[model samples]
Target: MDLFTSARKEDIARGAPLAARMRPRTLEEFVGQGHILGKGKLLRRA
Candidate 1:
């Protein structure tokens, strides 16, 4: 990533709430909520 893009992302994250900043950027990094996101689930399939 370029320095400008990296700085922009860092600035955005710094301004966000802790919860928002801590949220997983990808489904693979997510946890819990298995009832909806578990394997074979409709949302997971989508």
Candidate 2:
């Protein structure tokens, strides 16, 4: 919520592994898991 907190998060993300940095942060950004991510599926229901 403060400047340092946000800056630290950015720095950590910058240093993270490529996969970690590229991972989807939201369901809308996810793909290729239709069996579990489809409408009415358990993941969305949660």
Candidate 1 stretches greater than 4 Å from native: 1-5
RMSD, each candidate, Å? 2.6, 2.4
lDDT of 1 by residue, 1-46 (tens): 9999999999997999999878898876778778888889978899
lDDT of 2 by residue, 9-34 (tens): 99998999999989899887888898
Candidate 1: residue 34 Cα off by (Å): 2.5
Cα error, candidate 1, residue 16 (Å): 1.8
In candidate 2, where is summed lDDT lowest over 10 consecutive residues? 26-35
lDDT measured at residue 34 in model 2 versus the true structure, 0 to 100: 85
Distance from true location, Cα of 17 in model 2, Å? 0.7
Give residue 27's error in model 2 in angstroms. 2.7
State TM-scores per candidate: 0.46, 0.55
lDDT of 1: 0.87
- Looking at model 1, residue 20 earns an lDDT score of 88
Count of clashing pairs, candidate 1: 0
